[model samples]
Target chain A: MLYNAFLQAIREIKRNMMRSALTAIGIVIGIASVIAMVNIGKGASASITQSVSKLGSNNLLILPGQTRGGPGGASSFAKPFKPNDLNVLKSSINTLEAVSPVENTSMTVVYKDQNYRTNIKGVNNDYFTVQSLEVDLGRKFEKSELRTGQSACIVGKTVVKKLFAPDENVLGQKIRLKNFSCVIVGTLVEKGANTFGGDQDDLILVPTKMFQRRISGNNNIHMITVSVKKNIPLEEAKLQIDQVLRESRHIKANDEADFTILSFTTLLDTISQITAILTVMLGAVAAISLIVGGVGIMNIMLVSVTERTREIGIRMAVGAMAADILIQFLIESVVLSALGGIVGVLLGLAITYGVAIGLDIQLILDPSITVLSLLFSMLIGVIFGISPARKAANMNPIDALRYE
Target chain B: MIKLAGITKTYGSGEVATQVLKGIDLQIEKGEFVAIMGPSGSGKSTLLNILGALDVPTEGDYSFMDTNIRGLSKDQLALFRRNILGFVFQGFNLLKKTSALANVEMPLIYQGVSAKERHKRALEVLSSVGLQERVDYDPGQLSGGEQQRVAIARAIVTRPKVLIADEPTGNLDTKRSHEIMQLITGFNREGITVVMVTHEEEMAEYASRIIRLRDGMIEKDGHHAV
Candidate 1:
């Protein structure tokens, strides 16, 4: 009986093909938008984590003072972490792998008249280990050069590509940083962009003394990045470092630590939490469209039941049980929604693919979501279809037959 | 065979109450051709509906082939209708967009007949009704007389124990009416118990027995024995 009803439903849908097509359009658009939103959101979140991980999981940033705001503000005179703080963490914490005090100077780098205004990071040789950067060409600075504060620099891949012609060897080439001439000893590999879409490989790295004595003319460090040993957990290392920094600055247990010890995992978790909230908000908005689509199904089904009153009467008078009548109409609604769901899935794929291509992100189609959407559409049809089908089924045969 | 005793049916309540069928007794044996005659609102249609198991009487004992139809559940009554009874209506009641062949096969579909067997049986019945050439034509494409013939073919194709037709020729002209009556009587001759409701006296005369109804009661039951 069910099989026959299915066949009957197919025939009836074909009978009103135009109406059916129009009815299914709502579901198609709803599912498509949902899929596109979720996938793009996933892609954005994945890219953020990837970019953050590339900057090394062990690194921490210690800005001047305790004021929490954007970069480049006044240092609140609240005893900033000096270069001495790096030495204190290194000597005190056994889990500490490397600590680099970093200072930045804005300089015009001129390589044979190819001048580019860029920020330069001044740090010791241990900066590479602390920041998880790798040399793509030549070699990193030696301990002697960093200790004596030699005027040698490492360029990132973006700088190398911008400063030199394609086939020209940039290593050992003389580049003028401000008034002082520094040779490029190495080129850093491309690290892509940060979460805020800033290029990570667009700057140059120089020895700390050159930036402090020649560029900035100060002994204070703007930020200190620390790396912990691989065997030790980050939380334990953070606690140990916090104690060292507090004691270095002579702050008592009653007083809050002046320096912010941001571990990489915490930052990743924070970003993930924000992304999840956004996803839920966006997904909820998309779900509204699905409900509207379900309403569309219900609306069209009611109209169908109204239009086919005579048909229902005929079926009943010809030995159809009320349940049979109910099944026929119910299956018709299900078939309509199921078809809408199928086409919606395909439409979603196309939309997701186009968005992925246009935005240049990876397209990850989650089949679990597709199946869920399909099932949801079917459920909507069944739930919304019952009242109309019952109305159609329970219609008085005599009155229905007499309907004009 | 069908039997009904003290069948009473009413609609509405209190001052608005309208009794559609009063206490009535009827018996129709197998192979009998019975025509119920009355004017509009005379309860002829209601009696036919009850006999076909399409409606239940408010008070009555209805038995068909020794099974008490009044005690049958809705689904069981639906099964009884599907397996043992067939109906023809004045509107022809053929599925409007479907071919005459499909219309004839509908009852058999309810009987769980296979598609191939259903098509063969539908074609055979359509040919028997003189619609062999128009078997694939939809009801709208056929003439009124042809549509009625198709409806009759649909009715008898199941070879049901009884055929209940309400106003089968009411929507037709005299010539078409004669043709429809001939088709129905021919099926009755083949041993199907035929019960029909009609206001036309000429249509009623064609039956071997004529049962007259007035104000929901049986006025007369006469045999023509032709």
Candidate 2:
């Protein structure tokens, strides 16, 4: 019975092909936007994870202020950490692999005829080990150079490219900073763009003592990077670091520690949560359009019922049950929306493809979502189709036949 | 085999009440062609609707082959019409934009007939109505006579016990009306009971029994040998 209804529905749709296609455009756009929004959101979030993990997932960052709002920002007026906190964390945390104090400042470096702006990092060799970085063409800082505050520096690949010719031999070459000059003792290897698309190889590294004496003119360390051992869980290391930092900073028991401790995994979780919420929000907006599309279908279906009253009357006179009439109209709407779903899927994939390339993100097509959208479109038809179908089915045959 | 006892159909209530079929008691035997003739408001169409099980009489026991139609549910009444009766309208009410064969095949679709068998039966019935070559033609593409022929073919395709036609030739000219009457007569000869309502005297003569209605009651009923 349903199969025959489907056949009748197809014929009816074909009879009014133009009107049917036009009526389905609403569902097409609704499903299409839904698919595009979800897929693009997923691709962007996954891209973030990929880029962030590239910076080494086992590392934890300790900033000397509370994360005032969320994971990213810090309180600007908080006191800076001294080297004492770093020693305490190293002694207290058994899961520790390596730790390095990090101080940074951005300034322009000048080489004869060229000048380029870049960030300079103040750290020891432990910073490279924690970040899994290799200075492919350079040597590490000497113990005396690190301890005595000598004007020695290691330049990143970008700084080298901006300051000197491709093969001009950067070692022992002096580059001028804002108010002083430093001799480059090594040049670091190239690492590409980070997750947020900022260049990873765009900074110079100087010994911590020289950076404090010649640049910062203070003993304050702004941040610290800690790497956990391969088999260590981050929570255990974080607990010890928190304890040590709290004690060294003289925070009383039961008081909120005025420092923020962040791990790469925690940051990834926060970012994932943010992306999921964004996806749901975008999906909700798309769903509203779908509902509007459903309303459009209902409107058209009600009009169709009115227009086909005589037809319904004829079928009723020729041995059709009211259920038969109901099924016929219901099938018509389902067929219409399912067709829209198919077209929407193709259009959505086209949009996703175009935007993925344009935004330089990953292209991820979730097969289940495709199938779900198709089913959802059909469901929209049924949900919105019942009223009109009932109207057609409950028609008085005599009055219907007499309808002009 | 149709019977109607004390059938009363009234529209509205209170001061606006108008009874269409009042105290109608009629019986139609199998293989009989009965014509109902009356002026407008004589309740002829309402009586036909009751006979066809399209509407329930406000007060009546409508028994078709010993089954009470008034006792049937809405779907059951639809099934009663589907199984035992067929209808041909004055308008030729062949489903618009549908081919003659498909229109003829419609009743069998509800009867649960298989597609191939229904196709075969529709073609055979259309050919019997002298529309074999025009089976693929839609209602708009056919002349008045041809469209009525398709409607008749649809009415008889299910092999219904009674074929109910309400002014089957009202839209046709004299010659086309005669042609459609002859077609209905042919189906009656083949043992299908036909109940028709018409206003024309000439059309009434074609039926073996002619019943005339005045107001809501039968004024005269005459039966003759075919």
Candidate 3:
């Protein structure tokens, strides 16, 4: 009986091809948006985790800030740490393997007439080892160059691509940094992009001494990054560093510290929480469309029942039970919604793939969500289709037969 | 066999009440070809609806082969109609846009007949109605007479115990009306009890008995030599 009803319902839908397809569009858009939002959110979360791991989980960033690492706190105009603080933390903290005092600037580099604006980050050679970087060609800065404050720098992969030819011998080449020129000591390996889609290889690295003496001409340190010993607990390292920095900076024991330290774990957690919230918010908005789609189905179904009144009357007179009519309408609505859901899933995946490639994030399609979306669409049909099906089923055959 | 005792059907209630059929008591034996003739508002349609189990009488005892039909639930009435009665209408109520064979196969689908069996029986019935070549033709694609023939084929496909037709030739021309009446007569000759409603005397002459209803009452009922 159900099989026969299903066949009849399909035929009925096919008879009014344009109306049925138009009705299904609401469901298609709803499901498609849900799939696209959820999958993209998941892909971004995965990409964040991947880049965080690549940047080294044992890494800790010490920013000159107070309270949380939010925009206001991180970019606070507090007293920047001096080179003395970096020296103190290096000597006192036994758990720290290496610490780099970062003095950063965005400066224009010139080589003959070819010029490009890029970030100029100044640090010691220890920063490269702590960050697990390698010189792809030539060599890193020599010990004498660090002590003498020489103008020798290593150009990262992006700077090399922007400033020189691919096969050009870049070693010993001098590139002007605004006033003074710096000789390229090496070419850094490609680091690609980070989680926030920042170009990691798009900067030139110089010694902190040369940067302080020639570029900024000051002793203030903008940021400091340290790598903890492998066997040491990260929390203990943070507390030790926190205590030393407080004592070195002469803040009282009861006073709030004037610095903030961020670990990779905390960054990952914050990003993960944000992505999860975004997914739920977007999915919820998409779900509202699903309800609207269901209402559309109901509207069309009510019209269909009225339009086929004589058909229902004829079927009843030919021995169809009321339950038969109900099942037939119910099946028709479900089939319509399911077809829409299928198309939505495909469209969503296509959009996701395109966005993933464009934005350079991972593409992750959750299987359970795909199945859930399909079931939810079918449920929408059942919920919205009940009244109309009952209307058709409970119709008086005499009146229906006589309906013009 | 069919029997109705004191059947009355009233529409609405109180001061607005309109009585369509008033105390109709009738009987028909096995293999009887009966024709009911009446003017408009004579309640012939109402009587046919009660006989077909499409509507319950307002106050009456209706029994088919000694089984009471008045107390049967709506579903039970449907089963009774499915198992024992067939209906053809003046409008030629074959589903629009459906092929002739598919229309004929509809009643058997409700009967739970297998696909192969339904096809075979639908084919045989369509051929019996001389519509074998038009089995794939839709109602919109067929003439008035051809559509009526398809309807007749559908009604008889289930081998119903009684064929109930309401104004079977009301929408057809004289030539098509005779053609349809001849088909009904042939089905009746096959020993299936035929109960038909018609306003045309020529169609009435095709039956072995003629019952005339006037103002919801039977004015005359007896065997008429055809």
Query: What is the TM-score (0 to 1) of chain A in model 2?
Result: 0.96
Q: Please name the candidate that would achieve the greatest TM-score relative to the true structure.
A: 2
Q: What is the lDDT of residue B167 in candidate 1?
A: 92
Clashes of 1: 0
Candidate 3 lDDT tens digits, A1-404: 88887888789889888999999999999999998999999998999898887887888889887747442358648889997899899999999988987788999999877899999988898789778888999888888787777899999998888888779889999999989999998888998877677998999999988898899888788889999889888999999999999999999989988888888888888879889999999999999999999999999999999999999999899888999999999999998998889998898889889999999899999988889999999999899999999999999888889988
Candidate 3 residue A397 Cα shift, in angstroms, is 0.5
Docking class of 2: high
- Sort order, lDDT high to low: 3, 2, 1
Error of 3 at B31 (Å): 2.2
* Docking model 1 quality class: medium
| Candidate of highest lDDT | 3
CA displacement after TM-score superposition, residue A126 of candidate 1 (Å): 1.9
The stretch of ten residues in a row with the least summed lDDT in candidate 2 chain A is A68-77
Worst 10 residues of 2 chain B by lDDT: B77-86
Model 1 chain A scores worst on lDDT over the 10 consecutive residues at A67-76
Q: What are the lDDT scores of the predictions, listed in order? A: 0.84, 0.89, 0.91
* Candidate number achieving the greatest DockQ relative to the actual structure: 2
**Better model by lDDT: candidate 1 vs candidate 3:** 3
lDDT per residue for candidate 3 within B92-193, as digits (tens), equals 998989999999999999999999999999999999989999999999999999999999999999999999999999999999999999999899999899
**Which of candidates 1 and 2 reaches a greater TM-score?**
2
